[model samples]
Structures are given as structure tokens and as C-alpha cells.
Target: MHWVFLVLAGLAEVAFAFCLGKARLATGSESVGWYAAFAGCAALSFYLLNLSLAHIPLGTAYAVWTGIGAVGTAGLGVLAFGDPLTGPRLFFLATLIGSVLGLKAVSA
Candidate 1:
């Protein structure tokens, strides 16, 4: 399904973001793997996005993908990296979710 691929693309975007971040952190040999992962995910994300755009509106698909990617990345920051969940963070997260819902409604 396109939706499934879209979600995968979003997840892959998050993966690419994370790997690219790590690659920037590590030294020579270790960073190579990170860069490779980032590249692979980036390719997949772009491919699926292009495919989804054929059937879905570009604005809707792009918004959905990036919004979900933001939420997922923040979640990873909290759960995997022990990032703080301050009030402002929660507020932004709620706003992001709200925007996604509003977009869904408009797109529907």
C-alpha cells in the first residue's frame, strides 16, 4: 500500500537523520557505516516519496512524512538518548500532532 510505503519512508527519514548525526560524531572507520546507512535510507525515503507523490498530493505527503519524522525523532531522542521532556517540548509535540491532524482533515 502507498500508506505503508509512506510510513516506511518517514521511518527511513528518521533513520537517515539519526545515522547522519552519528556519522558526524564518530571517527574514521566507524563513521563509514553510519554514512552508508544514512545514504541508503535517504535513497529509500526519496524513492518512496516520489512514488507517493504520483497518487497523493505533494503538499499532503510531504507534510505527513516530515511531521511523522519529527515526532518519531523526538521520541527517539527521549527514549534512546535521554533527552529532556520539558513543557515547551511537550507543547511543540502537541502542536505538531495537531498540525498533522488538521492536515489530514484538509487533505481528506
Candidate 2:
């Protein structure tokens, strides 16, 4: 259950990063609804991650949250925004995802 929140927190952080770019593009000033939504999503992401830390160990959750957010965000960028997905980069990303899952499995 708590792990679910952790995953969600990571996803929200990804969404937050994505929205930040959109919000900036949309408003040009980073103000109003987009600003509020971006900040609010980021804040909520941290809060949820913190809550999960009570049961899940800070180090693991932090690593997982950061790792997943990074991977997820980059993947989205590659797929949606035509960012680079070079062989070495993809290899490294795959390694990261595998290691994160492996660690989680070992911990569990």
C-alpha cells in the first residue's frame, strides 16, 4: 500500500516536471493556474513520498522515487517530445530501471 503511494509520488513528480514545461509555455510568465498546479503537484509529490517514508526506509524510497521520476520523465521526453534515445542512453536507463527493481525486490 505504502509502496503504491511511493510509485504514485514518483509519477506525480514526472507529471509535475512535464507540466512545468507546459505551464511555462502556456503562460510565458509561470503565473496563475499553471504556476499553482506545478507547485502544488511538486509539493504533493514530496508530501506523499514523505508519508511513504514512514514505512518504507528513506534511502530506498528516495532512490526509487528519484530514479523512477528520472527514467519516466526522460522516457516521456523521448517518446512525446522527440528527445534523444541513443543506444548507450537507453542501455543506461534500462540498467537503472533494473537495478531499482532488483533493489526493491531484495528489500522486500
Candidate 3:
């Protein structure tokens, strides 16, 4: 389904963000691999997004996709990069997620 593709694209976007962070932090040979992975993920994300857009409304699809990616990437940053998860940040993140879900429900 197109929704599946959209979700996959969002996940790919998350992976792309994580890979980009890893690539930036890495040095020597490891950096090269991370960079390559980042590029692959980015490509996959965009490709899947394009596929989803064929069926889903552009505004709805883009917002949901980016919302997923943003939340996922922020969570990963907290877990992997020791980024501070302040109360306000968590609250905003939850709000964003709720908005995404609301969009999906209404679109359906």
C-alpha cells in the first residue's frame, strides 16, 4: 500500500539522519562507510516518498513523513548522541506525533 511506502520512507529518513550524524562524527575509514550509507538511505527515502505521493495527498504525505523522521531522529539523538531530552522537547515531540496520527486518521 502507499501508506506502507510512506512509512518506509519516513524510517529511511530517520536512518539517513542517523547515518549523517555518524558520518560527521566518524574519522578515518569508518567515516567513508557511514557517508555511503547516508547517501543510500537518503536516496531510498526520497524514492519511497515519490511513490507514496502518487496516491496520497501531497500536503498530508509530506507532513506525516517529515514528522515521523523528525521524531525518530530526535529519539535516536537522545539515545545515541546523549542529546538532552528536556521536558519541553518531549512534550513538543509528543504533540508532533499526535498531529501526525491525526492527519493519518483524517486522511483515511
Cα deviation of 83, candidate 1, in Å:
2.6
TM-score of 1: 0.88
lDDT for each of the candidates? 0.86, 0.86, 0.97
Question: For model 1, what is the error of residue 22's alpha carbon versus the real structure, in angstroms, after optimal superposition?
Answer: 1.9
The TM-score, computed over Cα atoms with residue i paired to residue i, of candidate 3 is 0.97
Model 1 stretches with alpha carbons more than 4 Å out: none
Which residue pairs come into collision in candidate 1?
none
Model 3, span 2-108: residue lDDT tens: 99999999999999999999998999999999999999999999999999999899999999999999999999999999999999999999999999999999995
Measured with C-alpha atoms, the lDDT of residue 56 in candidate 3 is 93
- Comparing 1 with 3 on TM-score, the higher-scoring candidate is 3
Clashes of each: 0, 0, 0
Off by over 4 Å in 3: none
Candidate 1 lDDT tens digits, 1-105? 676677788888988888887887899999999999999999999898887776678898899899989998898778767789999999999999899778767
